[model samples]
Target: MEKYMKNLTYESVLPFSEQVSYLNGQVASKTIAQNEALSLTLFAFDKGEEISTHESEGDALVIALDGTGEVTIDGNKHVLHAGQSIVMPARHPHAVFASERFKMFLIVVFPKKGD
Candidate 1:
């Protein structure tokens, strides 16, 4: 068998939020997989930390794994808590802020090369 995931234990049960750890005043991330078609990442943010406005070529889905966070898309703000999720469309401006110590799982899907 081939492995498409990394930085994580295989064949085991685990919580996604536990994969990454929060820092005192920074954001920490763990990349589980990355390829042209998709990307999987886990993020932990300290209270008040943020990822400023940006645009991506792919659609990004954010799954709140722990605590609370703010997701701003197209200038509108949306709050997310544990067990919640939101999607930022491709080419749209978006940002993420930690309302408190927060953890999230991010999955991005890109268009195929010819599409």
Candidate 2:
């Protein structure tokens, strides 16, 4: 099998664009291949857009591809900027806000088998 595939661009996945339910942004995610948990997304948000507060079911991570933002965890606020990334533990209440028009990626990973 090939080691990689063509990169996914936002314009290439136009039909899948969807709004972030809890926040005032949108996302476009694409599974790169079937064998890995890795994926990519193009997220867009209006300035001051905020997602609804919530928690995740499993370990997750996020990367700010292009923009400024903030994340709140358990009432604590932390600033996020382009090229920044963070890992979030399962079930922790968190919220994300776009201080300006923003774009990011969300990643969910499961433990490898027989670790």
Candidate 3:
């Protein structure tokens, strides 16, 4: 059997927020899964760190794991705290900012190869 996920412990109960660590003045990411159809990533952001506006080919879901973050979609900004989630639609311009040290889990679902 092939493992579909990586960088995670199997058969253990653990907090997802602890999977990644915040770096001083930097954004760090751990990729759990990656393929043509989906992507699963965990990110830790230091205060003031951000991902500039960009568009994704797939719909991306962001779930706050710790602290706080600001999500900007189509020019509108939203604040997310631990346990909160938001979806960014495919092809829409979006950005993420860390108002304070924060952690988040991101899941992106891409369309099938043939529509």
Residue 65's lDDT within candidate 3 is: 95
**lDDT by residue for model 3 over 1-114, one digit each (tens)?**
789999999999978899999999999999999999999999999999999999999999999999999999999999999999999999999999999998999999999988
lDDT of each: 0.96, 0.63, 0.97
Model 1 pairs whose backbones collide? none
The superposed Cα distance between candidate 3 and the true structure at residue 113, in angstroms, equals 1.5
Q: Deviation in angstroms for 98 in model 2?
A: 0.7
Please state the error at residue 5 of candidate 2 in Å.
8.7
Which portions of model 1 miss their true places by more than 4 Å?
none
Candidate 3: TM-score?
A: 0.97
Q: Mind giving the per-residue lDDT tens digits that candidate 1 earns over 17-112?
A: 898999999999999999999999999999999999999999999999999999999999999999999999999999999999999999999989
Better of 1 and 2 by lDDT: 1
Cα lDDT tens digits, model 2, 52-107, are 68986556677776668787877788787888988767678988888886666676
Reference-based TM-score, model 2: 0.63
Model 1 TM-score on a 0 to 1 scale = 0.97
TM-score of each: 0.97, 0.63, 0.97
